[model samples]
Target: MRRSIGETVILRYWNEGFEVQLKCQVEYIDNRTQMVIVSKQAEVLNIEFRNIYETL
Candidate 1:
């Protein structure tokens, strides 16, 4: 699914050899690069669109 800015989503990634899931807000998206920027706990993350497991 296509996500837009300001949308709330769940982001999952590997951290410390463990899969971590975080609920974050979409801050920006680069369609050409297929990259998304999300903010969680004051941290901004640059993640690939494919890395997004799901949108909520």
Candidate 2:
């Protein structure tokens, strides 16, 4: 499914040697860059679609 702004999502990606899971609210999306901007509490994260293992 496609994600949209204001939606809450769980993102899973590999980091270090493990898979990390983060839950954040979607803030913005850049289709050209295939990037997603999301906020979790006080932190804003930039995520690339290619780095994502899955979205739940």
Candidate 3:
């Protein structure tokens, strides 16, 4: 799978914080499987859903 900037990553907002999906937005391409995801609208950044790269 290939993920690029402006691409929406489907993630599940989790608890704890940064553990699972945070319903975050693609902030920037850090590398390949590593990216900066921001919190979803109306929700605070707590956990990360899943850092998965989309199929390109």
Candidate 4:
């Protein structure tokens, strides 16, 4: 699903013996870069995905 700014997303990742539950805002979704940029108030976050193909 394509989320928008101020939307809360569910993030699940277990790494380094730690689990994080992050509620962030979707700042931008870049099709050219295949990346999802999020923001937590003042912090900017970047997420990357490797898919066979992307949808429009």
Q: lDDT of all the models against the reference?
A: 0.75, 0.83, 0.43, 0.60
For residues 1-56, write the lDDT of model 3, one tens digit per residue.
12534555555443444434333455554445454444467553322225432322
What is candidate 2's lDDT per residue for 1-56, written digit by digit as tens?
A: 25458889888976666788999888988889998888999999988877788888
TM-score of each: 0.66, 0.78, 0.32, 0.59
Error of 1 at 6 (Å): 1.3
Model 1 alpha-carbon drift over 4 Å, by segment: 1-3, 13-18
lDDT order, best first, reads 2, 1, 4, 3
lDDT (tens digit, per residue) of candidate 4 on 3-56: 554576654444345655566776777889977777888999776644212222
Comparing candidate 3 with candidate 4, which one achieves the higher TM-score? 4
Where does candidate 2 stray beyond 4 Å? Answer: none
**Predicted structure 4: clash tally:** 0
Candidate with best lDDT:
2
Task: Please say which candidate is ahead in lDDT: 2 or 3.
Answer: 2
Per-residue error for 43 in candidate 2, Å, reads 0.6
